[model samples]
Target: IKGKIKHFMWKCYSGILPVSCNLKSKGIQLDEICKTCGEAPETIEHLFFHCSKSMQIWTLAPVTWEGLQEDTQNFRGWWNKLCTMKASRMSDSRIEMTAHILWWIWKDRNWWVFQQLKRSAKEVVLLITLLNFILHLSYLNYSDSIFLSLILRFSLHNTHTHTSRPIVRCRATMDAAKSPPSYSLRSKKEPYLPTLQSDLKSRRASKADPNPLGVKTSGKPTDPSRRLRNRCTVSKKSRRRTWSFGYADPIHLKRLGMWLNLMIRKSYFNILNTNKLKSRKTTWIGIFVKGSRFPVAIPFATSWDNDVVLVKVSPRKHNVLAMFFVEITSAIFVCLFYRQCLPGSLSPKKAAGKIVLCFSGNGSRAGKGAEVKRARGAGLILADSETYGSLFLAEAHLLPATSVTYKDALKIYEYIQSTKNPTARIVPAKTRIPAKPAPFMTAFTSRGPNPIFPYILKPDITAPGLNILAAWSEVSGPTYFVDDHRFVKYNILSGTSMSTPHVAGALALLKAIHPDWSSAALRSALMTTADLIDNEGNPITDAYGKPADPFQYGSGHFNPTKAADPGLIYNASYTDYLLFLCSIGVHNLSFTKCPKNPPHPFNLNYPSLAIPNLNGTVTVVRTVTNVGCRGPGVYIASIQPPPGIFVKIRPSILNFSRAGEKKSFTITIKTEGGFTGTIEKGEYSFGWYKWSGDIHVVQSPMAVSIL
Candidate 1:
């Protein structure tokens, strides 16, 4: 048997095949009734044996044995009986045939459930018989097993017809089969699988493959290199090509024209037209010391120029052995390591005119440089601790300084210990673009279930925050040290301040495109279109390299491109905000103006949802305005409920007849196992809800704080 068939058998015997009964037993909320017969619960035994469809498949199969229809209690026991059958009744060939039949039955069930395509029992039996014959031939000639497997797989996949187009089978000689297979797509009248050449051409033409033959689609581009970095490019040739596409409707063309016009009017195109701006140079620090082949280039964030010069180490050293053997005057000399180079911690006599080595923690990073400067140290070297991981921050120091990761710090320590005369030079900083695993949560970004209004989520969204290079004041020193006089036109900084501008810039662009949209609508567009994954196609991680939650990342990292045309928006007016304030117990609000029975804070029309005190059941209502196509559109609700919670959405399917049409839905949430009274503070779970349509997918993050 093939590996796939063997694995399927193993899953069946282990009772972990994801049948409805098994899924429900494992805490998944779903109907356990058999999807095929719509009768008995879907179990391993029923799905593969007792169901009417399965029984028909078995009866139609070429192989037969007595007691095959008799109840064996479970799939595992039945499988065990089949394996121990004597050759007189069921031969080894017949057993292999049974496995093939079972595999086909399962595949047919999946097709019916997921793809809404069903095949007759006789068709399934015929396919299994053909597969068994192929396997027998492959067993005789083992070299052709690989080729035969491909044929079996394709045959099984192409069994169901989803379109009116005709399917054609292409044959190859045994010698041709020896080489790798190639595909060629024909017209709709003679539909054939796409070849590699056709696939690449389609990708280059569309810049996207909406219906890849067997490839999985991603939110990010298929090829990273093709992605335009740093700036947006709107060329006339590309615009014309876009217009040529027959699928481009009038609304789409109008939006594209508006976006292009906005881009041209903005500084982005102005800089290109005037050629007044240049790409930033890569900045990094190279540390060169004695007894090393090459200098270690460290990625640093600073607005300083590149200058390389050798410097001597401090002559005054603290020996580790001296602490244990106090009387020993002769000890190996080495540079000292200060846990925190706080004010007055370093002695001027020893630190003067030499680079100081400081560990990161306890004190501010810039303050450490200031302390070294106070002691008349020539430069500073800040070594990160293990907890910091690979995250290095760029700071304007009082002196020439750079930070190194914990791994590199250990190497520096080893060199100082081994070298007799430790001397090094600081290389200038340089810049690098398209950093991987980017758009992550910074350690300093504020997180919350809004302290004052817990039902309203705080830190509404995340953006580029770490090691951001921006214009800076030339009058003040980077570190703002009183005695330090160094200044530059540009500086690299990190924190919520840096991240704020990124979101603000994104909003500015969105506003330019949709001037008629309200502030709340613009915010909704940005939040719903945010990216949850990083550049590396993984969940965005925090500074400590842990997967970030809604509290840390809010809706997600900002994506302006997607925000430009959000399919739907959750709009809220001034009255809505006022009502939200009143519902949250704002005392200053006038009772005469406020509604007698204000809606719950959670019911406010926001892109994201947060239930701060979920003790039992809570139902919240949200409304969305269709802003996509002018024609009819339908969206289906998909929920990834938080752990230990059951979420049920009313009217899971939404239908829109025209643009600007509004629809409302209610989400009812409750604990999985009945209420357990108030939960401990700070205990929460995170999830998301997505409304997927033909052309767009609008997603929103959800956070629930257990009470």
Candidate 2:
């Protein structure tokens, strides 16, 4: 049996007879035709190495072998030459791999013949090469078993690389994983190649081979482009903006969910008109404001020309000013294009100032996605009522000038504190205490009976919270309104919400200069020098009724121009808040409700509370007289004391007899009421009802004595 097995294997290796083929009797011989080619006579050397057709298949293999030179007609010579290649000897291990592959191919061929089946040349070579590589890898990582490695490699190769496409003819049992083998001249001339070509062509045309795995396609594909074009471009004829402003902030989006679709769609509305006035002369060049004419102005200018549309933004809401600033700053990214591009030419002279739509609402509602979407379409956002007040205070503090009145400073303070975050609660109150100074009471009645102090005297100051116009989403109501009122504009929205941004906008202008001031110092300067007068030219006090108290109006309503020239602003420092916190029994403060270790007061993390300190009311005097050229003057000067402090305005109502070159009045302040700590004395001058612009007003030197 051993002799028979050895002889059979040798015959199989030589490619003449299958390995398992049993020729027990001499009269019987192995079938004579090649299993792969099905044409040539079966011979050991013909099947394994010397077949003229089989040798052609080797050309397609990625590896080259020495067998090409050693033999043209013998299995022994082919195998010996392949094993002796420089590639095989240079790496002893590679030599073994080459031998294993040849052996596997022969074995597979033998198995196919014994089973009475045909195997393509490509399949044969693929199996051999794949198995040898796997076996080599296995030997490197683990103990290699020749039999198991060969089987595993062959299984993987067939599973992964067997394409549905038919293989072309090749020689010497090609690897299945390799590309279809190249056939020799004789095989190429055979009828199979033509048949295969015809079948492949039909398959492709019929879409049976449509869009194969890695093929590139040409022309337009079925899917659409990803970037969406602006839809508002359709109606370019219209040149006006009639926006319906909404006061809904992003945080309350859940409450405004039904309006979302409108909000989203409305963001694409027309913002700027591109068409210029036809009559205006179009210049391609102009002089630079600073010096030489680098580039001239041009009409209907292309992007290359230095041109930009300057927008003046106003805060529509209290919180929204900062939010809008942040949003717009981020959206346009002017900084990115500032230096690289040339500036744009100016707009036509008549169109230089277009009536741009701006928003004025609280940041809370304005910052909402829907509102922000609407805001993005506007030219600028403005700070309404109270926001303007707050900004006035900040301006007074930062910018110093001559006629800074208490009323202006106080109003500014009120605006700032109201806009402050809820956590920064520092509402001033006048608690009943001995040595309380008499508050200068002025009569201003509330519309309704004063409700008992509820929720700790909220909304420290009041501003107009009635009907207002704002952005509105078409989603909430009918798309087209039957009545103008039903349209989205001018809906009433009230709160410190509307008032806060009034001050914020003013602050924005001030910030335009000294942008680095801390929030605490800004607040202090605004509050300290405010006048205690009401709009009626009378001292502001609780006598005005309607839940009125010092706590309700921290300082007063803001006046921007007045704030710009405030005489002596109560410049505050960080130590003030800390001191106030200590006074209020907030010792050992920490960011955490209960921190184990509190940072030092001097630490950057420590909060700034710039409140003023009055050692004690000392004699302070100031004199002011109108030196105007003309006036029918009824001047009013009043003192507004700080919370828990008192003041007495002597002859508070100034009645000027006639328009005079000048008139003098004396004002004094005494710490007469509820103040435990040291009080500061300050005086201010005011000329009211002086209608003539020609009148010149001179204020006396104000002095304060602190004991």
Candidate 3:
């Protein structure tokens, strides 16, 4: 027996099992009546022995005694009698079985009281029997055939009916279940199972015949004996089918469990991959207020490590208070509201040595902080407007400061209104590593389908843009305020300016590794290997928390790790670019003349595909060069077609013999109907095509529009 079970048994013997009577004796206020039967006061003896439910379990159990009724007066007496075998014969297995029965009985009672789940006496007995059998198998070495025969005999005995069929059929079904099915990888047909056919036939026959087994059925079996028999003996065919489904073989079940465990492990690995390239230097702020249990943690982009504790003040809108003397803390300070915290608006006499709260807008975020510093304020809190949503930016401020979302600002406002005297402290910021969902598209990220050249996809890729900590110039104030004099060596900033360096750095690294590859090849490597899923192993979402598409994320968030080994890359030369420009009606170049018949801009061999106008059908060609993989490699094509569009590939497989080998494929896209307006107006339908091999998966985004 497990240590927990032994501990439970010891508690039962000591009369310290927390029964209702014992709880009442301990001064807990409640009726000490039997919770199961509810007919008598609930003592330990009544609960374990005299209760009608417990009595039914004992009767249904295989073990019994003659003087059990007399010993039931007290639990200790009954336990002593059972252990000494004064009322009945006792063996090691029989004693163990009794302990399991008692444990399950207590568990059932608790389940009924707490979860409202009620189990019958016969169900409890069946569970105990299975538990004992498993324990027996673990300790004793038994042959497979012997174990099967024992199980069959127990099942037949419980049914209380005799059948003439040979037991060999059951053994054969169990054997079939143990063996795995055989099928070829290239075969289209699934391997067949004989047991499945038989099971299906049995189900059909049962549905057609009201009494398939020639036994009368009842709507609800009320008699205890009838219910027990009905539960045990539903059908022989069903039992055989259950065994055929791998229940009879523990090894088969173990393999299935292992496969499920592996899938869960893979999912966790995908989530962890989101933080693979996260920066080590980052900073976040925390606001600690009096009377609150936990300090509100605010993730900020840039901040100064200056701590301050002062009385909080929220001045009335546009109200300037005259200087008044009050004895509270080190200084007497006044707070200015959002619009009143601007440059030349704050009265230095009233705002000195205080933290100012300013809402973002009338000025830049950093400008607000700079204005607070000009007034000799100790710190600043820049609250974002609703337009910013959950996105927070890092800005170089002239003073110790942090920015908060509109929602968190509301919480701080409420605290100020409810408190008699509000006091707050700003904890100095420090760097934090591996923030979750790191590469989400910022609310301010530019999205598009290329207004000038509709055939070419815009915003080719994404990278870490929000809250990036980078080196800063110390020549000017952090906020660039003319009067501000503060300087910092490092600062956090956001936007395309920050994201551009990330991609540039990646390109430099790839170029250093493969010095001969062109810029187009480098871009293709990044776009094709980008990740479409976020940290939680789900599709990446936009600022509004909806699943983002190619327009919002381009080819997906940049993944430098996978980009280093992109198996195939799409490359275009200068002439191809000129042709693309000519096809898009940009043929004003003085150095080159336009070709009489220029290739369509969509056929420029770009990493991504975009068809802004698909009147009926369009076929585009693309070429890829195998630059990474060695030896002969074969890749199979898989397509996730855009909604309301049907796409076909000329050749669904690519075979390459060596590095630098090129292969070309054509994609033909058409609407289900002859015309193109099936999807919502002005919305582009999205899809993807992947070329997968044993080692790599090369993917490209596809966008389609009706107008």
Pairs that collide in candidate 1 are 183-195, 282-430, 282-431, 283-429, 283-430, 283-431, 284-429, 284-430, 678-707, 679-707
lDDT of 2: 0.28
lDDT of 1 by residue, 466-583 (tens): 5665565555555555565655565656554455445556655676576456557877888898888887789888766789877766788777899888899998654465456557
The worst-scoring run of ten residues by lDDT in candidate 3 lies at 283-292
> What's the lDDT for candidate 1?
0.57
Per-residue C-alpha lDDT of model 3 across residues 1-707, encoded as one tens digit per residue: 76888999999899999888889999999889988779798887887776767765664454545445556677888888888893355567667777888888888789778887655554455455545544554423456436654774475334222253212121111111112122111111212111110111011111111111222222211222222111111233422321222122222222222111100000000112131111211000000000000111124332212222222211111111111111112222224353536667777776677666677666567677767778887666667766655666545565555666667666655555565544444433434444444445666544555555567665577776566555555655445566655565545555544555566566656655664565567778988998888766778776556677787677888888898899989986534554665676754332233566788877988888888877878999999998865656888899998888889887999999988899999999988765445587557899999998878889999999875
513: Cα error in model 2, Å: 3.7
**Candidate whose lDDT is highest:** 1
Candidate 2 backbone clash number:
92
Once model 2 is optimally superposed onto the true structure by TM-score, how far is the C-alpha of residue 270 displaced, in angstroms? 40
For candidate 3, the per-residue lDDT at 60 reads 46
TM-score of 2: 0.22
> Which stretches in model 2 have alpha-carbon errors above 4 Å?
1-462, 471-490, 528-552, 573-576, 587-707
C-alpha positional error of residue 422 in candidate 3 after TM-score superposition, expressed in Å: 2.6
